[model samples]
Target: MLRIADKTFNSRLLLGSGKFASPQLMQQAVAASNCQLVTLALKRLELDKPQDDLLSPLKAMNVQLLPNTSGAKTAKEAVFAAELAREALQTHWLKLEIHPDARYLMPDPIETLLAAEQLVKRGFVVLPYCSADPVLCKRLEQVGCAAVMPLGAAIGSNQGLQTRAMLEIIIEQATVPVIIDAGLGAPSHAAAAMELGAAAVLVNTAIASSDNPVAMAHAFALAVEAGHSAFTAGLAHHNNQAIASSPFTDFLAAL
Candidate 1:
């Protein structure tokens, strides 16, 4: 089970509800992924409206709605967005992301750490999306973040495990859950992250942009399970030289 704060989740795959062609497709993908937690961008929500069409279906599915500060450029902005999302969604679970640069969407680690400290003090379940720096991740955890989300690569880059070395270190040292987020374009990438002992992974663009999102979501779910199982089963040690699995014998020569 993946434990974040006091809540425990059976599924390790988290989904971002964006980039889908329609709300229906996104819903389908969510159902197919079997994710207990789904992230919704605060910028995409219409808080002033009586009811949101997009939110009703997701609520019906009974999954935890994780509101995010996607467009916040600073710590102050992220706090305001977090308050608004909490009010709108009626949930305190937040995915704190402060990316000042639009081109690469690289998460601002300083701003993220700042905001996480404030949010946790304000009685919110904070999960900050941050860079793949072990020191930064430790700082975020020290500030009481429920989990530290380190990137596998740039946001939506489809590059797999570009920061594998850093991620391994983060996972090794983290007391809190380390969720691999962003730039995971394929199921194999997700599996690799799980094999490295990530508590979970958050995916959006990969599944949303796929030709068959529902099927793709299912595939990712399977891959996460497979990877986690492999980790639990204990993988073989890395070796520079080859070792024979079968005994070499001269019995064939005698025959």
Candidate 2:
């Protein structure tokens, strides 16, 4: 089980509600994944359009909603977005994403840190989406962050753990949950992250854009479980010299 803040989750795979063809399909994908926590971007919601009904479908599934400040560019903007989401969504959980650059959408570390400190003070469960910087993760944990979501690659890039070395450092250092978010394109990537000791992984575009979203979601779910099991069961280290699995003494004596 993955425990973050006060909640304990059975599933380690967190799904994003974006890029899917429709809300129904999104729901189907999420159900197939069996994820307990689902991320929703505040900016993407058509709140003014009642027909959109994004929250309704999510609520129907009885999953925890993780609202994100996806478009915020600064500390002040992200805090404001978080407050709005709290009131609108009626949840204290917030995903802090402050990216000033539109082209790359790379998180601004300075702004993210500033925002995280303030959000923690305001009594919100802050989960900052940050770069795979081990130093930054330690700082965030010091400031009372519920968890740190370090990106494996650029958001929605599906690059799959480009920053593996750095992420391993963060996972080793973090006292809070280290959720591998962003850029996981396939189930194998998710499994690799779990095997590397990540508490969870957040996937978006890859699963949503797959030819069969439901099947892909199921695959990811299985991958995460298998990887976590491997981690718990203990994996063997690589060795240059081969070791025989079976004892050769009996065979040699018989011969």
Top candidate (TM-score): 1
lDDT score at residue 168, model 1, on the 0-100 scale: 97
Per-prediction TM-score to the true structure, in the order listed: 0.96, 0.94
- Model 2: ten consecutive residues of lowest lDDT: 42-51
Clashing pairs in 2: none
For residues 1-255, write the lDDT of model 1, one tens digit per residue: 999999999999999999999899999999999999999986553678665489889999999999999989999999999999999999999999999999999999889999999999999999999999999999999989999999999989989899999999999999999999999999999999999999999999999999999999999999999989988888989999999899987879976
**Highest lDDT model number:** 1
lDDT of 2 by residue, 122-153 (tens): 99999999999999999999999999999998
lDDT over C-alpha atoms for residue 116 of model 2? 97
Lowest summed lDDT over 10 consecutive residues: which window, candidate 1?
Answer: 43-52
Q: Give the TM-score of candidate 1.
A: 0.96
In candidate 2, stretches whose alpha carbon ends up further than 4 angstroms from where it belongs are 44-50, 246-255
Per-residue lDDT, model 1, residue 40, is 92
What does the lDDT come to for candidate 1? 0.95
Those runs of model 1 whose alpha carbons end farther than 4 Å from true positions after fitting are: 44-52
